[model samples]
Target: MRKWREIFGASQTDVAKIMGISPSVVSDYEKGRRTPGVKFIKRFVEALIKVDNERGWVVCKELIKSLNLNPEVIIDIRELDKPMNLDTFVTLVKGCLLTSTHSQKIIYGYTVLDSIATIQSLSGNEFWQIMGLTTERALIFTKVTTGRSPMIAVRVAPVKPAAVVLHGPKKVDPLAIILAEKEKIPLILSLASDVNELVNSLRTYARVKIIV
Candidate 1:
C-alpha cells in the first residue's frame, strides 16, 4: 500500500481525502498498526487506480501494458527498503561505469533481466515494468552480447532508469555507449563471473543497509 502510494506520487493527505478517511487512518494501515481487511484492501487499490486515472492514467497504462510480459523475461525484481548511493551500488555489483552521468544518484530498487528473452518477448510499452515501483533503480540486463539491443530498448522508453548494467558482455558496442551518453544514463558493465555471481551479489546488496 505504501509502495503504491509512493509510486503514484501521492501524499497520505491526498489519499485520505479521496478515501473519505483521515490521514492518520491511512498511516495506521500503512504502518501495520491497523490491519486492513479485504474490503479496505479493495478500496485502497481502487483509490490508487482512481488517483492515477484522474492524473491521466500514465502509471495505470504502463501497468496494464506490463501484464503482457512473459515471466521468463524477468529473473528478479526488488524494491530496496532504503536508497543506496550510485557508487556503492556499482561497487556491490562489481560494475565498470561506461557513461559519465549520474555519479550522485541514488537507487531505490533493481530488476535483473534476461536480455535475449526481454528483447525477443516484450514490446516497447511492456518495458516499463522493468522500472518496478520507481524509475530510480538499476536495470541490469544479463546475457548481453554487444549491449546494443538493451540500450536501444531503454532509448525508446519514456521512463529511464537511474543506471543500466550490462552483464556477461566482454565488450560493449560503441553504439550502446553513445546511446547511454546521449540519454545521460550511467551505463555499467558487470564484471561478475556469470549470472549466478551477479544475482547473488545484488541479492546481498539488497539485504544490507548503508550507514551513510
Candidate 2:
C-alpha cells in the first residue's frame, strides 16, 4: 500500500479521504498496527486506483499488475532529466556489450529491477511503466544469473526498450544475446558486484528526478 501510494504520489490523508477513513487509521494500516480485512483491502486498492487516475498518470492499471509482485522487493524506476546514449551508459558502467548496437538511441530513463521478480511479477505492458514513458529507455536487471530471463521478458513485452543491462559477473547467456540481436536491443553485461551502488551511479549520471 505504501509503495503504491508513493508511486502514485499520494499522501496518507489523501488515501484516507478517498477510503472514507481517518488518517490515523491509514497510518496504523501502513505501520502494521492494524491489518485490513478483504473488504478494506479492496477499498484501499480502489482508492489508490482512483487517485492515480485522477492524477492523469493512468497508473492504476500498472499498479494492479504490481499487486502480485513481492511487497518487500524494491524496483528502482526513475525519470531522467535529459536523453542519454546507450554507448555512453555502457561506458559509465564499464560493461561489455554482448550484442550489436543499432542506432545511437537516446534514452529518457532507466529501470533497475530484480530479474527473478521481473519474471514472476511483471507482464508485457508492465515493463513499459518500468522502462519510463518512452521506448528509448534502458531496462537494467540486477541480481541476475544467466541474464536470460530479463531479456526474455523484454522480448515478450508489448514494447522493446532501446537497451538492456545485466549486472553481476555471470557470463551472458548465448540465447539472450541472440534474442537481443533479433530484437535489435543493445545487451550489456556489467561486472559490477554492488547492485545498489551501480543503481545510484546510474541515477546520478542520468540526473533522475523521479524515483518510484
Candidate 3:
C-alpha cells in the first residue's frame, strides 16, 4: 500500500481523502497495525489508481503495459525512492558514456534486460515495457553483441529512456552511438563482469539515498 502510494507520488493524506478515510487509518494499514478486509483493499487500490489518473496516469499506464511483457526479457526492474543523477548510476555500473548528450540526466528507476530475448520477443508496442514505471530510468541491456539492435529498438519506440547501458559488449556499434546522440539519450557501456554483478551493483545503488 505504501509502495503504491509512493510510486504514484501521493501522500497518505491524498489517498485517505480519496478513499474517504483518515490519514491515520491509511498509515495503520500500511504499517500492518490494522488489517484491511477485501472491500477496504479494493477501495485502497482504487484510491491509488484514482490519484494516479488525476495526475495523468503516468505510473498507472506503465504498470498496465508491463503486464504483457515476457519474464525472460526482463531480468530485473525497480523504482528508486528518490531520483539519482545519471553520472552516479553510470559510476555504480562501471559504465563509460559513449554519447555527449546530457539533456536528461536524472533517473527515477532502472530495468535490466536480456538483450537477445528482448529484441526477439517484444513487438513494437510491447517494447515500451522497458521503461518500467517511467521513461526517466536507465534501460540496461545484457548479453549485447554490437549494441546496435537495442539502440535501433529505442529509436523506433514512442518513448525513450533517460539513458541506455550496454553490458557484455567490449565494443559498441558506431551506429548505436549515432542513434543515441540523435535521440539525445546518453549511451553507456557497462564494465560489470556479468548480469549478476550488474544487477547487484544497481541494487546496492538503489538502497543508497541521493539528495538530488
Candidate 4:
C-alpha cells in the first residue's frame, strides 16, 4: 500500500478522497492503527488502479490478476509512442481486449522517428513526486541549440521545484516530447542545427518559448 502511494504520486488527502475518508484516517490506515473493512480495502485498490491507468501503467494488469478485478472498471491509457515496458504493454493489450473501448487513443500529436536517443531513469525517491501525475497529457516544447545554447526548461509528471536537467546532443522528437509530458520525465533535445530553426520547432508543441 505504501508502495502504491509512491507510484501513483498520491497524497494522503488523495487517498482519503478515494476512500471517502479524512486525511488523518488515511494516515491511520497506513500505520496499521486502523482496521479497515473489505469494502474499504477494495476501494483503496481501485483508487490505485485509477491512478496507474491514466499514467500508462501496464503493471495494472498484474494488479488486476492478483486482485481478481474486472477490466471494465480499470482505466487504461495505451496510446503512447511506445510502452515504457513490456509487462505494462501486455497488460494494456490484455485489458483492451477485454474492454468494449479497445480503440480509444490516450496520447496524440506525437510522432515517432528513427534516431539515436538516450533515456534516463529517475530515482522514485520521495522528493520525486511533488507535482503528482494529475493529467493524462503533459506538453513539452524543445528547441535545440548549436554552439552556445540557451538554458532548457522542462516540466513532467511528477514535478519538483528544483529542475532536473540533461544537456547533450540528443536531437528531440515529437514522440519523446509527448512521452516526457505524459510520463512527467524531464528531457533535453540537443541539436547541431541553427538555433532559430530549432526554436521554430517549438511552434509544433506550443507558442511558449523554451529557449534551449
Candidate 5:
C-alpha cells in the first residue's frame, strides 16, 4: 500500500480526500496497523484512476494494463529519425543493459534529467512533465552514482518508460537491476565520460522532444 502511494506521489491527505476516508486511516494502512478489505481495495483503485485522470498521465493506464484490467486511453506516440530499440540505444551510447524483459520495445525519444534535481523537485504530478512529449520515451538520468535511487523513483511511477539510461556509472547497483526487472523496465549503464556530450548525442540521434 505504501509502495503504491509513493509511486503515485500521493499524500495521505490526497488519498483520504479521494477515498472519503480519514487521513489516519490511510496512515494506519501504510503503517501496517490495519489492512484494507476487498471493498476498500476496489475503491482505492478507483480513486487512483481518478487521480491519474487529474494528473494528465496514463500512469494508471499502465497499471491497469499490468493487472490485465484493460484500461482504454488514446495513447500519443511519436517516432524519431529511426526506430530506437534497447539494443541500438545502448550501442549508440556505449552502454550495456543489465536487466530487460523486453529488449525490442521501441522509444520515440529521450529526456536527460538530473537525478538530484528529480530527487529534490520532482513530485508525482511533475513526472509527466519530465517525461516530455510522451510517456513512451527513454529517461536518461544524469549524475547517477549507484543507479539505485533513480530507478526506485521510476518503479514507484504509475507509467514506466521504455527504458532507463544511467550516465556516468561504471557499475550499477544490483538492487537497481532487480527493480528494473521487476518493473520490466530496461536498465542501462552508460560508460560515457561526459554527461553533456552524451545528452546531446542522444537528443540529436533520437530527435527527442523535451517537454519539461
Candidate 6:
C-alpha cells in the first residue's frame, strides 16, 4: 500500500509502468481493487529488496580506500577483497531506515528479448529480459547514499523505426537508453532477444557513461 511506495520512493506512474498495468490498476491495488497474484507478489518483494539495498537498512559499514568518492553507487557492482579497520574513519548515510512499513516490494511486469519490440510495443521494458551476462556481478548496492542528486528525467514511451522488418528481433536497449538519459548509467545492448544480450550489453557498457 502506502508503505510500498514510500519504501521505494516510487510514484504511482512509475510503479504502473513497472507493473505493465495501467496506473488505474496500480491505484486499484493500492486501494485493494484486486488481490495480487503470486507473480505480482514475487516481483513486488524483489523490487522492495532491491530498493532497500539501495536506500534503507540498519546502520551498515562501508570502507573508503581512497579519499575520493564515486558519483554514485549502482545495483550490481564489483569489489575487491582486502583487510580494513573495523572501527575507524567512516561516513554515515543520511536517511538510513531499517525496518520498512511493509514486508514486501512490488514489481511492475514487463520484458522483451528482442530489440525490435519497441516498434510494436507501448513499453519496451515490458518485453525485455536479461539477454546475457559476462560475469557474475558483484553486489555493489546503495543504501541511502545521497548527495547532489542527478536532475534528469526523460519520458520514453516508444520510438519509431524508419522501417519495420518483421523478421529479426527488434534490436533495442530500452533500459540502457532510459538509465543513460536519466542517471548516466551504463548499458549493454543486444542484437538478439535474450538475457545473454542484456548481460553482454551491461558488461559492454559498465564504465561507458553517457553525459547529457
Candidate 5 residue runs with Cα over 4 Å from true position? 1-79, 128-134
Worst ten in a row by lDDT for model 3: 203-212
Error of 4 at 81 (Å): 32
Clashes of each: 0, 0, 0, 3, 1, 33
Q: Per-residue lDDT tens digits of candidate 3, residues 156-197? A: 888888899999888899999999999999999999888899
Per-residue lDDT tens digits of candidate 1, residues 64-159? 444766767777765554678888888888998988857688997788889889878886767775554338878899999999988988898888
Instruction: Estimate candidate 4's RMSD in Å.
Output: 17.1
The C-alpha RMSD of each candidate to the native structure, in angstroms, is 10.0, 11.7, 9.8, 17.1, 14.7, 21.0
Return the candidate ranking by TM-score, descending. Answer: 3, 1, 2, 5, 4, 6
Which pairs in model 3 have colliding backbones?
none
Estimate the TM-score for candidate 5: 0.58
Q: Which ten residues in a row have the lowest lDDT in candidate 5?
A: 69-78
Task: Look at candidate 4 and tell me the lDDT of residue 44.
Answer: 80
User: What tens-digit string does per-residue lDDT give for candidate 6 at 129-160?
Assistant: 11111112211111111111111111232321
For model 4, the stretches where C-alpha displacement exceeds 4 angstroms are 58-212
**C-alpha TM-scores of all predictions:** 0.67, 0.62, 0.68, 0.28, 0.58, 0.26
Error of 3 at 165 (Å): 0.5
Q: lDDT of candidate 1?
A: 0.80
Q: Which stretches of candidate 6 lie over 4 Å from their true place?
A: 47-212
Give the C-alpha miss distance for residue 123 in model 6, angstroms. Answer: 45
